[model samples]
Target: MTEASMRFEEGEGFARRMDAEDPLRSFREEFLFPQSPQGEPLVYLAGNSLGLQPRRAQQYVQEEMEDWARLGVEGHFHARRPWLPYHENLTGQTARLVGALPLEVVVMNTLSVNLHLMMVSFYRPTRERFKILIEGGAFPSDQYAVASQARFHGFDPKDAVLKLEPRAGEDTLRTEDILETLERHGSEIALVLLGNVNYLTGQAFDMKALTQAAHARGCRVGFDLAHGAGNLRLSLHDDGPDFAVWCSYKYLNGGPGALGGVFIHERHARAEGLPRFEGWWGNDKAIRFQMGPDFVPLPGAEGWQLSNPPIFQLAALRASMELFDRATMPSLRGKGDRLTGYLEFLLDRLPSGFVRITTPRDVKARGSQLSLRFSKDPRRLLTRLSEAGVCCDFRSPDIIRAAPAPLYNSFQDVYRFVKVLESHARD
Candidate 1:
């Protein structure tokens, strides 16, 4: 449906009609939602923070357990899905989800671990160009990782890290301002790292444009796709960023603390003399089991692996990826746009001075999340939401982030959440 035809209205009936008309509505049954003490499912709107567990995840994980118990050591080679090359099972689906070549993507360690690993190769700092550019107020983990990386290279974080801040009184960064910043400081930058979608304000960046601009300045570019992976229709290969990393627990619905993913551009697949911290698994497969002292790296993203992945994590993720492969990112992203648009429409009708959306109004500039900036003590509002059986997250100081994931969240979920907000505002 076109944006004009969405014709969003503020009532339960309208929400039910939209849910009925939704082509992807059946996908909701694939997930298991949290229940209240009264036995009703909570209106889950926090897919930006943690996605609901996929029902099939339990079954998949159980199969792996059964294999381990029945086969023991032999499971590595004889399990239903061999453990030795198990991560490979996820490669095609992960690559397609993020718009990458299979060779460029790998399921690996947690997000921060992969970020540091990517930095080992891509954040090659030199005397003349030593600064790393990132958006101000990046997710705390990223800020910590970038700061420590600079410190590891004997440079002060203050000098090595440059942050891009929004314009005065603005909540989100403008594309022109970002491009101009790159042009102005391009020569001094060694790496340009950004969250593909800002976790706080739910601002989505122009990866392709930024990559072109950064490359023109001779800077290596990377992104933290923690918020972008499943929420947005990414073109990681076409966008031409050097590398990117993301955790699977959130929109990917890989279960709590599930494995992370990495993407390295094909251009750097076999770049000679590229420095990295290598492990036995990263060695070329033919020689890997030969147990050579020398690390003969595999081509592309798989070459960055530090160790064999946990089988249970891979099993859980396999379940989620199978669902994604069937549903597809394009279809999921389309539904996401409509869901968030309906949410924004309902929110705009709330009492004007009570709260304001910090996320960009332009649909193209955001994913599913809408961050509400409250004028009062937001914690009180959070309490109200919790009591009402609404599930969303609070970001420090004063913001409540709600993301209506299209894969499982219905239009009725969005309507119900707003009704709670409406009730709180009236009080």
Candidate 2:
């Protein structure tokens, strides 16, 4: 058989062989994989966008629905895993995923909302030193949030929000450039807010080094962990940021529109006089049901909560967190690194200009996603790949994102993805 024909005939069996060897292969059964009308699984490589739902999520949510139907108001206290303290149960797992202490992390509102709340406390800007620095090409949600916040304070975002862009012709930002920007503007910057991983380029920033540098300049630091939460292991406590926020729907496998999570370092736990966006849920936990006029905030990250937990959303998160707890981040990250590296290796073997990896090649510089920038518009290739049953995502202009999630993706998935790419290139 010719090489191309052999690849097609042997690809599925080869991939199944790799799946058999995958340490995390068992985890794949935990999620509800998308199937064709005939019930066969589709090759899923879009975990970086919306993860497959955990099979246990329906059962978890069903329990809540039954409790609400049977117990009504009493469900808050009488149900198994009482609704009153439900959010607390997932803290330890969430902390483990993000490399922070249980007390430092909390599940609350969505990503953008948590960011605004974090800024209420962390973004304390003054007349001379009021600028905030962020990585260039950050998610539009973040850019809008920062711009609106700056405008709210009478600071022009054009001036108050300084973006650290890569040098001309470079796809990813360099650490040296980031640090240099800090060094030059550190004195005037109040807070350094950056994404732990860049969304489009899949570049994972050096959090520990960057946070430490920002602190030395007396600037508060925070992170938007939308891309890093499940894709990479973060030492959030050790890195010591003022706060961080992330969404659970991506690599966490919490389904679409999952609730967001937040982390606040323990050092700020008992801060008596910090500004916050207040609500009843953020009041003293002990006195929360007392229904009085006092405004006592809960300690640590929980203090940022402004409303009651969304039990249905929390149920989905809880189911996913259980799976995460069973498999730690280190093991997951290890698998992801190898799987993505394999994808990179195969892509590099292709002809020059046919495909160029926009995501950094260095293992330390990226997470599971390998962004491919085709020499021409990539949408045609994306549509072709989709029709062929290889699932990935396309960003505007020319980038296509493919991720190999350790939780559900198998080695064969990577193998087949390459197989499809080879076919697409020739077409």
lDDT of 2 by residue, 300-380 (tens): 899888999889899998998998888899888887887777677677776667888889878888899998888754787
lDDT by residue for model 1 (361-384), tens:
888889999999988778998988
TM-score for every candidate vs. truth? 0.98, 0.95
In terms of lDDT, model 1 sits at 0.93
RMSD per model, one decimal: 1.0, 3.9
- CA lDDT for candidate 2: 0.87
lDDT of 1 at 233: 96
- Model 1, poorest ten-residue lDDT window? 1-10
Show where candidate 2 strays beyond 4 Å: 1-17, 36-39
Clashes by residue pair, model 2: 15-412
